[model samples]
Target: MLTKDDVRGVSAMIPTPCKEGQGGWQYEDSVDLDETARMTEQLIAAGIGSIAANGTTGECAALTLEEKLAFTRTIIEVARGRVPVFAGITTLGTKETVRQMRKFRELGVEGGFVGLPLWQTPTITNSVKFYADLAEAVPEMALMVYANPLFFKSTFPVEFWEGVGKHCPTVVTCKYVGNLMDPKNMLIDLPASMDAAPHVQFLPIDFAAPMAYDLVGDRLKGMWSTSCAMGPEPVVALQRAIDAGDKARMGEIMHDLHGLPNAIPDFKEFSKYNVQVEKIRCNAAGYIKAGPCRAPYEDLPDDWRALTVASGKAWAELCARKYR
Candidate 1:
């Protein structure tokens, strides 16, 4: 089974590349496997610590089971065990989630990123049971809890983590996009959640990472980043600074990051079109071809498009200077 030690640095949540003219969610065999392989190689070469695909950023909801399986296989083949690879196995119910995870495990994925079943808001007891059941069923597969309050019903409170620590041993990490709206909640929850589930690494997203690392020291372990899709070097540089305890350097990188055009002042507004914005930035960065946002979520407001593209271009420029 995987452990907290197995996950480190920047864990990149990458986008799925859609084939030309096939960006619609319902399009059959729309995933570009060759590009997927190339993208995987690009990330590994650029020093990403680990790679996760088919999450919110990867358009997990829009991908067909066959496409997801193919995408997972492509990434695993390209990675060739160079860096740990995780594939999202989130579904609307427990049975399907387990089924998808089993398939991905067969394809040699290191772990599965799972979110809570989304049909209804699960009670805290049921939430714990959901993870426990998955662990029990797929004892060989390690799990990363996808704890995003914006997409899922559960906020993943301290109580949930306490139950997971006791009942779900295979859960080794979390893609923690915690309560960003209430910064005070994070001030309370980050420490308390870690205390409740000491064995699991709670990886805060890129924006919140510096604070999280300072709050918990080495226990912060790593971070989950969608922006790394723009390019990993800048994000990896931040990881190195954090590890070296270079607070000044950390501030420098973060300041430039916050200066990006897509770094909206209000996170709530940003969340509304995050999936689309990420795709725009990734395409603009041109680090790897991210193709287009999959259907139903593809459209972005005109102002958001302009800013997002500008952010992507700005990131590419910053990356050129190596975030000087």
Candidate 2:
């Protein structure tokens, strides 16, 4: 069984590799279980605190229900109690989301990471009800609320967050990826407000973990890590530095980790290729067998593909130098 404390470190967002098939794209509808299992083993070997499956980086919206559950089951199976597998439940409505969560729970998963229902942007009351319904439906399972306003299109106020946390004890963590506050000249934002609901730990998305750590330090439980998905070593190393209170080492690791993506042209603007780039990095690092993303997403421009692969290789080289 996994506890809330188990998630207080670097949890890798494991990517779902596609299989070769007779489609317009090279890899479509083919959930490559062998490669996914292999990748899970590698992440475990690299010392990731936990594995998060079917996230944005994992192309959760692109997968079928069957593929999603299969991927989650494979991760849990391969993990073999070495580390807890936190399944990602991203669906259209509260009913479907609850179904997915219950299914993963039936599969023996201890917990899940669920984003706000994306079908429509509900009001704070409805959002609170949505999560409350989910928590009530599956009272035994724990959840981490995904707070990225870019996709969810709603900024939940502190009251709303605390409402959900206090109302549902099953909701243990909240990963905020929105523009909640100034990352530059800030000491604390979410964590201080989150004290109202002491059970729920607040974390920035993995990208902002360094800034959050630099400002709030150990006040954060841990980030929901996307960077750790691609480059686990440097990201985990950064967390270790923060834990040890070594400022100099933290700066070095942050540079090495952030520098990897910045090495590419207009990397910040390359949101379209974010999933592909992470998959490319995992392949470059020998974490998974190389494969294209499922259709619609597979049609990457040649230049973008070239740049992403080059960036992944360059990042791997940096990781080898510093983390190895």
Candidate 3:
């Protein structure tokens, strides 16, 4: 089984590929395994430490159980132990979540990030039990818990994390997507409180990684990057800057990356279209074929193609910069 430190470094979140349909909308067949496996190989070649498939970036909630397992197996098969591969085990049922993790473990995946079951946010006792049960069910597989306010309805206090860390030895990472301010406090205070859960590393979500890296420094060594899946070089370059403590280069890389999301006009309006944007970015970077997201997610905006291309080129240029 993988440990917390073993899973450190750049983990890319892959976007699911879909088959194009009439009116440019995506159909149920959008999950193309061959394309996904190809994308995973590309990220590994680009120096990503791990591959996180079926996460929110992969549109986890949108995929069926079979599709999720297929994605995990494809990643594992393509990766061939070159690096750790993680599947997102977020589903609506507790037993179902465990079932998926077991499947991933059976396929030889090292670990995965899991979110709470959908629709219902149980009390702290039940929540703690949920994680404990999950760990017990899949004792051999390492796990990361995703705590995002935007995605989850209830507040998961640090104490809850402490409980998970204490009880679930397999829980090695916590991807905290709550307020940016929260990590600051956790960085200062939570370590001692969470000592019982010694191996559980805390990380901010991908979008907030730059700020988190800047503030938390070495304590927060690894990150999960969505942009890196589409374009790993830029994100890897940024990580190198942070590791070397090159504030100037870090600033330069940030300058290049910080504005990328905004390149889409009315970004806030289409902000919820994350998987679609990632697909566009990945396609622009030549990692996969460009296509639309599945149902309920409308077609990519008119200007997204142009903006994604611009963003991809600019990012590639930044990646070429000398970090030494």
State in Å the error of residue 217, model 1: 1.2
Per-residue lDDT for 275 in model 3?
A: 64
Evaluate model 2: give its TM-score. 0.88
Worst 10 residues of 3 by lDDT: 21-30
Best candidate (score: TM-score): 1
Question: Per-prediction TM-score, please?
Answer: 0.96, 0.88, 0.83
- Scored by lDDT, model 1 comes in at 0.85
Candidate 3 wrong stretches, greater than 4 Å: 20-29, 180-196, 259-271, 299-324
In the range 191-234, model 3's lDDT, one tens digit per residue, is 44246467787665555556666565666666777777546776
> Mind giving the per-residue lDDT tens digits that candidate 2 earns over 1-324?
344666777777677777755223333346888988888887788777777788776888777788788888888899997876778897888888888888899999888888888878778888888888888899888887777665686776677776776677787776666563434533245655566667776766655777777666677657667655455787777767767878798777677666665423553445566666666666665546646666556556677667677766776788677777
Best by lDDT: 1
Global lDDT of each candidate: 0.85, 0.71, 0.69
Candidate structures ordered by TM-score, highest first:
1, 2, 3
Taking the candidates one at a time, how many backbone clashes does each contain?
0, 0, 2
What does candidate 1's lDDT look like per residue over 217-280, in tens digits?
Answer: 7777788898888888888888888787788998998898877675454677876787788888
Model 2 worst lDDT run, 10 consecutive residues: 20-29
